[model samples]
Target: KDPKACTILLRGASKEILAEVERNLQDAMQVCRNVLLDPYLLPGGGAVEMEVSHRLTERSRAMTGVEQWPYRAVAQALEVVPRTLIQNCGASAIRVLTSLRAKHTQEGNSSWGVNGET
Candidate 1:
């Protein structure tokens, strides 16, 4: 009904480029539609993983014995998500991980994450 509200008109030099643009536009449009239907969007990046890892790690300390090991292992594994994100961004994994860990542990800020731009 609203002609100019949400429309895509792509023009390209070659068929291949046009096709690629059309495909990408379709994919983006689908994402927009899905978001509109289900507005509950999870936090992007590794924030969720870090939060889960932090909670798991804290709970692991309460366990009596060997049961704690699994929780600790899973928590450590969850941390790999953000660590890999940092390394993929051409940053020092060790430095970023250390900083993140300190922020979460010492400062009690579980949401702290490495800025990819750095």
Candidate 2:
């Protein structure tokens, strides 16, 4: 049995162009090596913010004192992640966020999010 791969030939206008492409490919490979070696990945794409906001909101509701206000404020601020994502996608932030919130509540899935393309 043979492990196999195909060669990719990059044609460029000049030696410098090829050199630059090679340098970028090497840089990307180095990053892959680092990831493989360390294997530490941070949560991204607004998931962490959304989860934090949800948890804080729940915790705030359970509180019966002034401390709840601060937690509520932080939760509301955490919402900016999804709101900004929708806004940047050229969608109506209020409408999308309202829909997203409804979906999350109804489906009971914290991962529910707006489709930026739609």
Candidate 3:
């Protein structure tokens, strides 16, 4: 047998659109390639960041005074990941992030992230 070749056609109204779409497709393909090379999957939509933030916040509780502040600060800082994601999508960052934070307070919901699709 020979080999199989696959083709992908990108259609857009303008060259700029075509180029942008091509770049996006290339990025997606790169992610696929990377996952194939390294067989591990990470959640998208800032899930990991939210989880880290939740863990940091929880760990901060054990600290006394100054040490606790840093952990809380970093935890708040980590929220910026999903907050920025929401802002970029033209959504309400405060509202969505607050809701996500509330959800993360519950056990087993540490991975909750802002849904940009909403």
Considering every candidate listed, which one attains the maximal TM-score? 3
State the lDDT of candidate 1 residue by residue for 1-118, as single tens digits.
7575875689999999999999998999899999999987654457668778878988999998898999999999998999889988999988877777666675446557768787
Flag the better candidate by lDDT, 1 or 2: 1
lDDT-sorted candidate list, best first: 3, 1, 2
Q: Cα RMSD (Å) per model?
A: 5.3, 5.1, 5.0
The best-first sequence of candidates by TM-score reads: 3, 1, 2
| CA shift of 76, model 3, Å | 1.7
Residue 31 local lDDT, model 1: 96
The TM-score between candidate 1 and the true structure equals 0.57
The residue-level lDDT of candidate 2 at 73 comes to 97
Error of 2 at 60 (Å): 0.6
lDDT scores of the candidates, listed in order: 0.82, 0.77, 0.85
Least lDDT summed over 10 consecutive residues: which range in candidate 2?
100-109
* Structural similarity to truth (TM-score) of each candidate: 0.57, 0.55, 0.60
Cα lDDT for residue 79, model 1? 87
Candidate 1 — worst ten consecutive residues by lDDT sum?
A: 102-111
Clashing residue pairs in candidate 2 (N, C-alpha, C atoms within 3 angstroms): none
lDDT, candidate 2, equals: 0.77
